[model samples]
Target: MELEQFEHTIRKLFNKELLEELDDDYGFTNKSRGSFKTVGYSTNLSLETIESAAENNVELMVTHHDAWDFIYGLKEECLKKLKEYNISHFWIHGPLDFVEFGTCTSLMNVIGIDRVTKYSIYDNGDVPGVGEFNEPIDFNVLVKRMRDELEEPVRMWKNNEKQVKKVGVLTGAGHSSNYIKMALEDGCDTYITGEATLYTIQYAQFAGINLLVGSHTFTEIYGVESLAKKIQELNTAIKIVKLKEDHFELNH
Candidate 1:
């Protein structure tokens, strides 16, 4: 299918307006945008992911994080590889996270939390910062379950807690003290997310709520994978490949 049509289809499927962020300064070349047969989806558009798509002959790579950040200009190496292979980058960022069944809720389900609800405030229709789990559980169990469920090691900042009944989740770097504060206000005993900030770590201890950080990339897999699955179901004419991340730095 034409790349434009493919993008349009995706926009409709995921509620385009929700995904308000895009690489406004960057877009694919005319030749590269003409067609897309195999679509690759990832939470991060790392060099590994781009190489996999290019090597596998994927026409486009859809990612939650920009392949090149605005601050860095672009990854010159990755750019050359994309141009060399004629693969395009597509981003589904903030809007993707803000959807009703997006990141927050997906994380809640993955961690096996019960009575998960979109209780966090949102910048759009979907909540970005919070999900509340109704049942309290042992802090240790929650850690073990999350590590097992995400298939990644989990880091934590604890407040000498024993149990976690009510919990809040803000997947990825969304694990902010701001949401943790709100979670505590809502009676959540623990706050779960990825990439806990330094200040937030201090705050979690002071606020007396258990804070859990699953590696940022792993916590985010749920939403993008779910998105990829939905995209795959829409049609077989288009091949969608999920470029799963294979490595995680344990002590980084």
Candidate 2:
């Protein structure tokens, strides 16, 4: 498939224009935009890499970063680079996190969780940030189950205290500090996230809520990667590349 054609399809599938409208800036910021060589501090490639990719006729480029950052000068530069290589870029950024059945939903599903509830206070809201299990599970068992199902070790911020019936999950970042009070207000016994900060762990301990950090990239990657797989399955003509990149650093 032609690169632009692939991008067109993806734009339609993701309602890309609507996304752009919702966040005029597309939530672009100066913070790190994943681990791409073109983005990170330790970039190894040069103009020649772009030349080589162009020579290879690479069709599609998937990025973890949003292509709308003011500092990065995204849209023009991205399209220019991709056009030179005859490649089209489909970006999934905040939309990847905000979509109802996107990243957080995928995480809950993988952990056999259900009946997601939402919380919005101080103008902050998300679908998967807060949820409840179908049935109550012991805290220890829940941790073990999450570890086994995600196939990644889990880090606990609080001891196993009470049975977890209602829980909150936020993919990537401690975000616990932002949502912890809201989760508590919503009667959640435990809060789950992909990465946690030291103060967040302390907050969890004091907040009387169980907290778990399951690794940053390990959590958020599930949704986009799954989208890529399903797209590949439906259309044999297009190629899918799951960028093997982890840009965030979370210390356990």
Q: Scored by Cα lDDT, where does model 1 land? A: 0.70
Q: Which residue pairs collide in model 1, if any? A: 18-95, 19-95, 98-126, 135-165, 136-164, 136-165, 137-164
lDDT of 2 by residue, 1-252 (tens): 443444454555556554665454232222222212221110111233334444544344444454434546545564566556554444465666666555676677777777767631112444336778778988888788778865677887554467899888777664647567767777889888877777778788888999877876667666666556555654566555444343334343
TM-score for model 1?
A: 0.84
**Mind giving the per-residue lDDT tens digits that candidate 1 earns over 1-252?**
786676676767755444444324223422466876788877777778888887777888877776545637456766777778878877666655666566777778777777665543344222334444465567888889888888877887678645677777778776566777777777777878778778889888998888888877888878877776677677568887878577464664
Positional deviation of 32 in candidate 2, in angstroms? 23
Deviation in Å, model 2, residue 214 alpha carbon:
1.7
- Listed in order, each prediction's TM-score against the native is 0.84, 0.68
- Judge candidate 2 at residue 219 and give its lDDT: 70
Number of the predicted model whose lDDT against the real structure is largest: 1
Candidate 2 global TM-score: 0.68
**Model 2 lDDT at residue 93:** 56
